[model samples]
Each structure stands twice: as C-alpha cells, then as structure tokens.
Target: MTVPAYLHIVQYCAFGIAIIANSLLLHLIRMRAGLSFGRYRVLMISFSIYAIVYANIEIFTLPVMYMQGAGMIFYVDSVLKNHQDIGLLIAVSYCGCLAFCISMLATHFIFRYIAVCRQHHIHIFNGYKVYLLLIPPFFLFLIWAGAMFVCYRPNEVKRDFYRKVIADLYEEDIDQVAFIAPLYYTHQTDGSVLYRISDLLGCLLSCGILGACFTTCSICAYKTYNKLHDSAIQMSKRTRTLSKQLFWTLGLQTLLPFITQYIPVGLVFLLPLFEIQVGKTMAVPVYLHIVQYCAFVIAIISNCLLLHLIRMRAGASFGRYRILMISFSIYAIVYANIEIFTLPVMYIQGSGMIFYVDSFLKYHQDAGLLIAIVYCGCLALCISMLSTHFIFRYIAVCRLAWKMEVYSTEFLT
Candidate 1:
C-alpha cells in the first residue's frame, strides 16, 4: 500500500511524542515515586519501558488493518514494506504488544491486590522476584504472536476471496501483496460453510488469554477495593490515603485500555463467532488525497509560472483570467498548507464514519473541528473551481460571442 505522506508525518510526530512522554514517565517513576512504591516502582518503570517499546514498534511498522467480514487484512505501509520477513516480525510484535498491554495491566491490579489483601504473596514482586511479575505478560506476548503467525497462513482460496477488495481498496494485486488474513468461515464444494478449526482455535486462545487477564484484573480490583474499605485491616492515615489514591489511579488507567483495546479485540472475535455479517466499505480516501495533492502541487507551480509569463505579457494576453489563475495559485498554496498539516484519518464502522485529527490542533478541540471543517470546505470549493475553470475555458475557446477581446477592455469591460 502507498502510505500517505501525512501518515508518515503523523507516525513520526507520534513517535517523537511517545519517546519524550515515556522518557519523562520513566524519570518521574524513579525520582518522584515515594518510598511506598518499593518493589512496585520497579514494576511501574518496567511497564513504562514496555509502553515505549509498544509505541516504537507500532510507529515503525505502521500497519494499516482493515477488517472484512470474519477476516482481516493486515499489511504494512512503512519502510519495512520491502522486508516481508522483518515486517512480519514487527507485525506479530505489534499484536503481541496488544496482549502484553492487557496482561501488564492485569499484573498491576493483581500486584495491588496482593499488596493490600494478601501480603504473603507480595514476595513474588520483591527484589529479583520482581522480574517474575513480568513473566505472564511476556508469555502471553509470545503465545499471541505465535498463534497469529501459525494460524493466519496465506492461501489461494483466501487470496482469491480477497483479490478484488485488495485491488479496489489498496490498489495492489493480491498476488503481490504480503498480508496475514484469518478467515474463520471456510466454504465447501456444496456451498456449505465449514468452520476453519485453526481460525476458531486461534480465537479461543486469544479469548482465553483476554478472559483470564480481564478476570484477574477484575477479581483483584474487587478484592483490593473491599479490603481497603475494611476498617478491620490496620494501616496509617498517610499509607491508607496513598494506597487508595494509587489503586484508584490504576483502576482509571485500566479502564482506558479496557475500553480502547479489549472491547474492540473482543468484538473482532465475537462478531464473527456469532456470524454477524457487517459489510465492509474499504474507502481509505487516500486515493483522493493523493490525486488532489499531486494536482495542487502542479497547480501551484504551473499557475506561478503562468503568472510570471503573464507579467512579461503585461496581463494583455490573458487579462482577467491571469488574475483568476494567480488568485487560484495563492488559494492552492493556502489550501495545501491547511489540509496537509491537519490531515484527517477517517474510519468506517457499520453504517457510520468517523474523522479523526490528532495533529497540533488536538489540544484545541473547537479549533481542530473548525480547521477540519475549513479543510473540507476548501475541498468543496476546489471541486467547484474545477468546473468553473472549464466553463471559462469553454467560453474563451468555443463561444465567440462571450469571448474576451485581447486588449479591447480598457477599464471594467
């Protein structure tokens, strides 16, 4: 897939931001974290490092995922595109990170629960034993990646099925594209569908991992919350307050990924398991952007050159059309600056579509929205300008009656 120039801009921007942000987080965890953190501070720093790794791999790979029916086509649009073997690892690592994210969060909650409710087991996270806390997430990470690599083998039937969509959506031949697709439903000679056992089992494995992690987090959170509330358990005022604050903060943090990652991953599995056919509209709008930007660049250059030529001609040859072209050239430059910088990523789900902008305008909510609107409004004007430009050309070239006489109009004529 041809990556959007703006996507590279976005990913690199995000990469820089994630690096700085996570670096700061690591520093904060070490310096600012109080004595109460103890062994837990080690876990926190490890997770922050994990997050940095997560962001680095994701940004580097820049995988564009499109879900179709029960299957999904995952491919990279990055520097790694030519290196399928490496890209494959990066892609699998990206998937593993998803699992690790869940498992790590679960560990955090479980650790908290143990610290508050069962101090005896807290030894698992102390000193060198602290590294043991990382085992579950890392284990799940490998398992998830292994399952993805083993189960989602590229085959002829799957290739044939995906051929048209690949061509239409990505402008890439199915044969040429290296993508991982796991189609759950297999069609037979009689047109009856048989369950792809590999796909089903993969989903089971994924679901089991997800369920266990979520369940652990839930049970620990519940027990820890109740334990903290229990007046019977003796603790100092500062200790109690700090524990409660950290517990609630972890709970809130867990909620973010649970909502963002877990729920969507569940849907990816559950929707197909129930055989709900949600039609996929794979309109990336990247094609439009490509053509528009390419034309806009030419427009800027050619129009500027034309204006220079008209300047040498002293505006007598092209007249008001020269002024119009110059105005359009200026407009094109302004439009390019605004739209390319605040380029929107659009997503389609079911019958709805979403436009997301995570550019510099992200902090300014209303301004971001207004800028998006302006960008879109400019696009509409560009469309209108195309027709208007052609109409004026038709009048000048084909219609003699309405044609402007060269050097005939002295003033407003």
Candidate 2:
C-alpha cells in the first residue's frame, strides 16, 4: 500500500522534532548537576541513549520506506530491499532494544519495590546489583540476535530464501522449515524454526521478568502506603509530595512499553494465527507506528510553549505589530487544527479516498462547505491584516497623520 502523502508529511515533521527534542533532553540530563547522580541517573542515561539510537535508525529507514511507496508494510524484503543482511540486523536491533526497554523497566520496578518495602536493604543491593541484573539481558540479546541471523541463512541462496519467505507470508510469513519442524527441532537448515522459537523465548522471558517486577512493585507500594497511613511517624510534606510524584511517574512509565510495544506486537503476531477478524479499521502495527511519532509531537508542543514563555518573561514588546503577529498566530493555530482533524478523519472515513480538495468535497458535502468557509475566512483575514500593515506603514513613513486625523474627525461628525 502506498502511504498517504499526508501521513508521510506528518511522520517527517514528527521525526524531525523528536530527534531535536530527544537530543536536547539527553544533553540536559547529562549536564544537569542534580540529575547526573544515582541509580535513576544511570537508568535514564541508558534510556536516552536507547532513544537516540532508535531515532537515528528511524530517521535513516523511514525515508526509504516512504520513497519506495512501501506504506505500512514491514516485511523484511520490502523494507530492506537488496541489503538483506543489514535488514536482518535491523530486525535484531528492534528486538534487542525491545528487550532492553523491558529490562530497564523491570529494574526500575525492582528498585521501587525495594525502596518501598525494604529501604534498609536497598543499600545492600547497591549499584553493582543493577549492573549484574542488566548483564543477563545483554547476553540474552546476543543469543537472540545470533539465532535470528542464522534463521535468515544469509550464507545461503538469497532468491530461494526470498521465495520461501514470500510463500510463507500466508502463514504469518514463516518458511516451511518452521511449519514442518518440531518445536524442539534443531538443525543447521532450521533457520525459520529457530527464529520462531527464539522469538517466543525472548518474549516469554521479557514478560515473565516484567510481570514479576510489576507484581512486586504493586505489593510493596500498597503495603508501604498502608503502613505509613497507620503509623504515628510524621513524614515531611516535601517528602510525601515527592513520593507521590515518583509513584505516578513510575506507574506511567511502566504502562508506556506495554501499550507501545507489547500489546501491538501481540496483536500483530497472534491475530493472524487465531484467524480472528478485527475489521478493516483495525491496524495493530499502525498503532505502534503512530506511537513512535508521539515523542516528536510532544517535543513540538513543548518547544512551542517554552519559546512563548521565554518571550513573555523577557517582556519583549510587540508594539504596533502585536495585533498583526497575534492574528497570524491565531491563523496558524486554526490552520493546523483544521488540517490535523480533517485529513485524518477524511482518510479513515472516506474508505480509500485520496486526500485532495475535490475528493473531500465530493464525499463529505457538509464538511466541505464548512471547510470552504474556513479557508475563505482565513484568506480574507490574511489579506486584511496585510492591508492594515501596509496602510500603517504608509501613514508612518509618508507623514499622513493629518489625513488620518481629518478622516477620524469626519467619522466622528
């Protein structure tokens, strides 16, 4: 499927913003005095690095996907094209980073669990404890990566492998080796089977670890809260507020990976196997793609707000042009909202309709009328603003104050 141009445009814009914002954030974290210490700092720095690498890969690959007209197709052949080895590595990178993300979250939850339930023992575990815990995932990632590389059989005939992969797309893009081989089967030629087995193993391991951490954290948090509530020991207001904030932050971060990675991956892999129909509107991977763009959107909004705040604080006088600048700002806001709402709605609802002025008007008449009015109003406002600016400039530059005063007096009479 050729991706809609609007989607491509949005993705590019979002990607750009995300890259800048993530880089800035990483720099700030590294440079900030208070944030540069402790277990939290280490984990955050790791996350920032992960995010930067992921964004870099996306920046490189997204344009290729967009230009090739691959749309939302994620098949290895379509995305990687002639560079099959690199493609396989990219796939491995995706899974490895996913595992890394899960491990990070698990570690975070464990820390929280200990801090809440066994604060005295936290020092015993220390920084070395985190290092030990993180090492296993790296080893696991290596094992998973090596297994995936072998599964594709890069040393073998490329054409044969491509055909096999394509043939198996019907059965979730598995090779015959996967369908025919037993779960425990192990052979040099059993690339596909090993791939499936390894994927399942990695996923199971991540889920098990994450689940354990989450359960522990939940129990600890509840117990700690209750214990504090019942105890006569007084906690400082600042301490209580910080604890509450940390609790919510961790809770939100814990939920993030599940929605963005786990659930979407689950649906994509499982839905086909079960032959469940989720309707045309359901695109599980699309959700993941959209989620990837979220960082960019957030960055864009944040930067805009920050700049506005800076201007306000600096007391930058707008003078006679304040109204003019304000008008343009409002116009920009309205225009952005209109396109954001209208394009997505039309594309999703129009049922294969291309996003164009004619198609939209033809398909959604009332909406078209409203849109037309908005366009004309915006154009009129823009022209009026320009005319007002030119008139003022002429009055100021050409010494037309007397003419303005005479006109004002005639209007008053």
Candidate 3:
C-alpha cells in the first residue's frame, strides 16, 4: 500500500481508539461523578471536545490525501481554482482547527498544573471559569483564521499552491507559473505589501497563545513538584500518584500536538518568511524526516509511560510478559533511534553536501570513514534486531490467539 493509504488506515484506527477510549472515560467519569478528582473530569471533557475537533479536521484532510494519492488533484484543484470563497472557507477552517488544537492542549496543561500546585486556588477554575477559559480560544481562532481573507484575496494563495503542484507535475518552471485563466471569480484583495504577512500573523498568534500557556503550566508544574518533594506538604499518597499520572498524561498530550502540528506548521510559515527554497522533491524527505523524528521521540515517551503503568498495576511479578514487554520496548527504541538518526544523515549525504565532503572530509578522512563504518554496523544491527523482535512478537500473539480460539470452540461444542 502507498504511504498515504497506510496513513489513512492508521488515522481510522486512531479514530476508532479515540471513540472507544473517550466514550469509556466519559462514561466512567459520569459513573464516578463525585468520587474522582473534579479537575480530571473537566480535563476529560476538554479532551473529548478536542478529539471531536481533531476528528473533524482529519475528515477534511483525508479526502485531500486520497485525492492526491488517487491522482485526482484536478477534482480538488478545480474547486479551489474556480471558487474563491469556498477555498477561503476551507483554508480558514483548517487553520482554525490547527490553532484550536494547541489552545486545547495549553488548557489541559494549565488545568493539570493548577489542580496539583495550587489547591487553594482550584476553585477559581471551577463552575463558569472553565467555560471562561475554553470559549476565548474559539473567538481568538476566528479572528486569526480571518487573517488569510484579510491579508490576501480569496483563492489567490490557494491558487498559488495549486499552480505550484501543477508546475511540479508538468516539470515546468514553478517560479514563472501564474494564473492565466480569465477573472471569472471575485477576488478580495487585502493589499498588504508585506511578504506573506498572513503566515507571520498566524505564527505570532499560534505561538503567542501556546507560549503563554506553556509558560504558565511550567511554573505551576515546578511549584507543584517542589511541594510534592517537601515533607511539610500535606498531600495524600493517592493525590500524589494521581498528580504524577496527570503530569505524564499531559506531557504526552502536549508533546503529540507540539511535535506533530505546531513545529511543522511553524516551519511551514518560517520557510516562506525566510525564503528557504525547498523544491518539490526535497520537501517530501524533509517532511517525512520531521514526522519520523517526532514519532521516534513520542514512541520513547509512550514506552516509558507504558512501563510505568505496567509496574504500577502488575507490580514486579508480571512474569513472562515483563520480559516480552521489555524486549519489545528495547527493540522499538533501537529501531526508532536508528531510523530517525539515519534518515536525516542519509538525506544530508545523499543531497550531496559538496562543501562538507570537500572541506571536512578532506581533513578527517580516517575519522569520517570510521564513523561511516560504525553507522553502517549500527544500522545493520538495528535491522536484524527488529526482524527478530517482530517475528517473536507475531508468533507469541498468534499462539495466544490460537489457544483462546481452541478453548472457545471446545466450550461452544
């Protein structure tokens, strides 16, 4: 299957997981009601809202991905090419979703930090305060999303993107490509002489909001951690454990959006602002490298979290599963590290860094050769380890499933 197809399947799986997990969480929260921490319930509600928004965003994005992969660019391009207002609405909503995600994560961090650090001040976040906190991001995004419309005419920027895609496909000079069709659609010009000012505005808006939220959360987390370490502090053992869980969960939540979305979008904006000439071919590898790097880090974080959860729930007597899990974790880490490390290095080397090879390689020929050989060895080891790990895992899981199936069949008979 194609990469986009694989990604599409993964997205659907994620959506399924989100639906089930979030539904269970919400149901449990309702069942427990006053039993658990009030802040947790509120956070879960926020998470649910964010998940719905994210799913919607994915719904819009999947079609574009499918269209691209299916060689139906003309289908999307025609609408984007012909209808200025439709393109503007789509662009604005997409940007809004991106900002909304960050905003929600920021709120998650803030809520968790406040709940742990400032118990006395927790009442401030209750009742109407939650609504007060959550609603502003919607309005803020609406304003920020409108910048595209204000900064440029509807369909103008989108037309540029479509034209760029067509030019690359036709092997035409992308630099000289312009909209040659007659002025059939109405165009609203913002008349801003600033170069790609909409992007700068977007960067400032997204970064400003997220930065503020991050800073606030950091301060709260520090104070809370310090309090936890203090013997004088009167927090219950359960509270402390819950606090740690909250922090870990928030950390994962924060990292996913920041790594996957925030940084990539920031780069997208900055590249135009800085005039980084990334050609069509070069862009894919760079984009994939960024994605893989983020996934690598996230996988490590998740493995650690999973280990912690296992220890917490299963104690030290997990038996064979402990060894199995540990081996899987180790292999995953090794493979991800190798993949992430090699991809960018390979990209750099393959891209033909003449200056580096000429100047540095000339002076350090022996060292460079040694480094390359060591890297090759490590890459080979990673491949071998991953192959073994996958084979063992598949056999173990399949055997377990077979046993379960046999037992079920016997019971039915």
Candidate 4:
C-alpha cells in the first residue's frame, strides 16, 4: 500500500529537522573548548552519517511506493524498475549503519584491551590516530558490499535456486523465504533467501560487536569511577561534574538503540509464533516501523543533550537546570494538548468537517487551520526546548572556565 500524503510530509519534516540539528552538533563539537575531541569525534561523525543516510533512504523509497499505488502498478516491479537507484540508496544507508555499529564496537574492545591487557601502552593511542580507527570500519564496509552484491541477483534466475541460495545464507526454512521475496520481484518471490541471510548475519555481527564493546566500556568506566572515589585529595569539582555528564551520555547512547530496534523486532517475531492472527501480523510490522522512526527522532534530540553534557564536563558554565526544566515543561504542555485534542477532533468531526468547510466556508479553510495550529504549536515548543538546552549549556561552560581560573590563582597564592 502507498504511504499517506500526511505521513510523507511528516517524514520529510523529520528528516529535514534531524539533518539540520545533526549538522549543527558537528559544528559545535569541532568548535567547543576543552572537550575530548579525539575519543568522541569519530563516533559522532559515524552516527551523523548513519542518520542522514537512513532518513534519505526512507524519504526516497516511500515516494516510489506511492507512485506504484497511484499508477496501479505492481510495487515489486516498480522497485525493480528503479532498482539501480533504490540499490544505491540501500547500499549507502547500510554502509553507514555498519560503520556506526562496527566503529562503536571496535572502540569499546580497544579500550578494554588497553585497560586490562596493556595499561602501560594506553598512552600510545591517546590521540586516537585516524588511520588506526578507520581500519575496522573500512573492512566492515567491504564485507557488507560483497554480501549485498551477491544477494542482489539479476531478475532471470530460477525460483528454486534463488530460494536455496537464500536459505543457505540465512539458515531459515524455505517456506519463510516466500514471504520476504515478494518485496523485490512481481511474478516470482523476491524472497531471495540471500538478502534475508545477509541481513540476519549482519544483525548477528552487529549485536556481537556491540555486546563486546558495552561489556568492556562498562568495566573500564566502573574501574575509573572506583579509582576516583578512593582518591582522598580534595577532588576537583570540575572532574566530578564532567564524569557525571559523560556517564549519563554513554548510558543513554548504549540503551536507546536496543530499546528502539531489538525489542520491537522481538515482539513482532514472537507474536506470530504464538499463533496471533494473520491480520495482526501487519499491525506488528507497522507499529514497529513507527516505533523505529520515533526512536530515530528521539536519538537525534538526545544528541542535543549530549552537547550540553560535553559543555558541562569541559568546565563551561551550563546554565541552571531550571531553564531546561522549564523548556521541557513548555514542550510537554504543547505536545500533550496536541495529542489529546487531535484524536478527539478527528473522531468527533470525521469527514463531515471537510464537507462542512467546503460547502459553507467555500474554501475548506478551517480543517487546514486546525491542523496547522496544532502542528505549529508543537513544533514551536520543540524548537524552544532545543534552543534553550544548547544556550544554557554554553553559558554553563563559560561559568566553569571563570571558576577554574579563580581556584587556580588562589592555589598559586
């Protein structure tokens, strides 16, 4: 089925906002003072590229589906007709996703290796040499590219061979291949066992790498915290504050993706095995899509908070938490009202409002006005929250610098 126009608009707006925010974040990190640029810079760049590619692919592919619906053509045929473009889009997106995942995983492992196996040699890698960091991600890209090329066979192959190839790759039942293959071709199932197999492998690899990284990072972080706690000399308040911010950022980053991707996928897959109705199967995937998009939006917004944490850690004056609280409150109020009112209005008025406006108002204006007011109000509030959070953090960092200088002079005297 084609995506609704409203959803297309929403997706476009979301992509636009995320790209702008992520770009600004990259700039801030580069310009920000006293931040550990070497350690976090690659991570941020990888994530930003991943987000951009993901959003673009969604935006491009949805319209293709929409065109198929409008023309009453087969969706799979349309996708194949546009295969070169679509393939490029998916290739770029998956590459970025792989880079982000592998880099993060590698970073954690390297840190763990240094901490546990070669503590004395840690300083040798302190500057985070770009050449060393790029090696793992580059290898990951090459592997993904090879798999994708193999999976995306030309449309003339026999169905049985295709299914066998896919099943062999993913290790799934031949029957299950039929379900996913329709996505790529019209007469024969696109359920190239190959694509599913590759995807399954990719997911497993990503999970394994991420698991190792998290374990190592957690251990290192805990050890560092304990060591700091045992130190009796009056600890620098700046150091303590910075540690807190870093901990919060890392914790949120580690947890959000699993909640967004794995949990939803697990729930969807489990529902079917439990004998849920076939009709409900679509609901699970649909809901999963929504949840995934929401997660992406939240992750992008959360980066704004990350910037604030970096500023605070750098001993820059981050403005009072009260401002952030107030900004959040304003956003909550606007969002809650929009959510509470929109459904009721849509239900109570129904299509009657459309007819009413067309007949009486002669312009069908009120319907548009209502939607505009609700959306605009919510958007305004979100912008306010984002702006205030970043500004307050900037102020806080400045304050930290002033305090640091004062303490330094007093100690010297």
Candidate whose lDDT is highest: 1
What value of lDDT does candidate 4 attain over all alpha carbons?
Answer: 0.46
Over 317-354, each residue of candidate 1 has an lDDT whose tens digit, in order, gives 66567655766767777787776656577767799998
As for lDDT, the candidate ahead, 2 or 4, is 2
Where model 3 places Cα greater than 4 Å from the true spot, the runs are: 1-34, 62-84, 152-165, 170-199, 282-284, 304-314, 341-413
Query: How much lDDT does candidate 2 score?
Result: 0.50
For candidate 3, which ten residues in a row score worst on lDDT?
65-74
What lDDT would each prediction earn against the true structure?
0.75, 0.50, 0.56, 0.46
- TM-score to native of every candidate shown: 0.66, 0.53, 0.66, 0.51
- Ranked candidates, highest lDDT first: 1, 3, 2, 4
TM-score of 4: 0.51
True-vs-predicted CA distance for residue 133, candidate 2, Å: 4.3
- At residue 403, give the lDDT of candidate 2: 38
RMSD of 4: 11.7
Residue 163 CA displacement from its true place in model 3, Å: 2.9
Per-residue C-alpha lDDT of model 3 across residues 1-413, encoded as one tens digit per residue: 12334445766787778777777777876776564567557766776766776665554444221112101121112224334455446555666676666666666666776776677788887776677677866876776566534543324544545455555444333233222211111224774343444444545665676567567657766776676677787888987877776677677777777777777665554444443533234234344455677898888877776776666676544434455466666766766665544443332346474322221333576855554555467667767767865665565567777535543435535
User: RMSD to native for every prediction?
Assistant: 19.3, 10.9, 10.2, 11.7
Candidate 1 C-alpha RMSD relative to the actual structure: 19.3
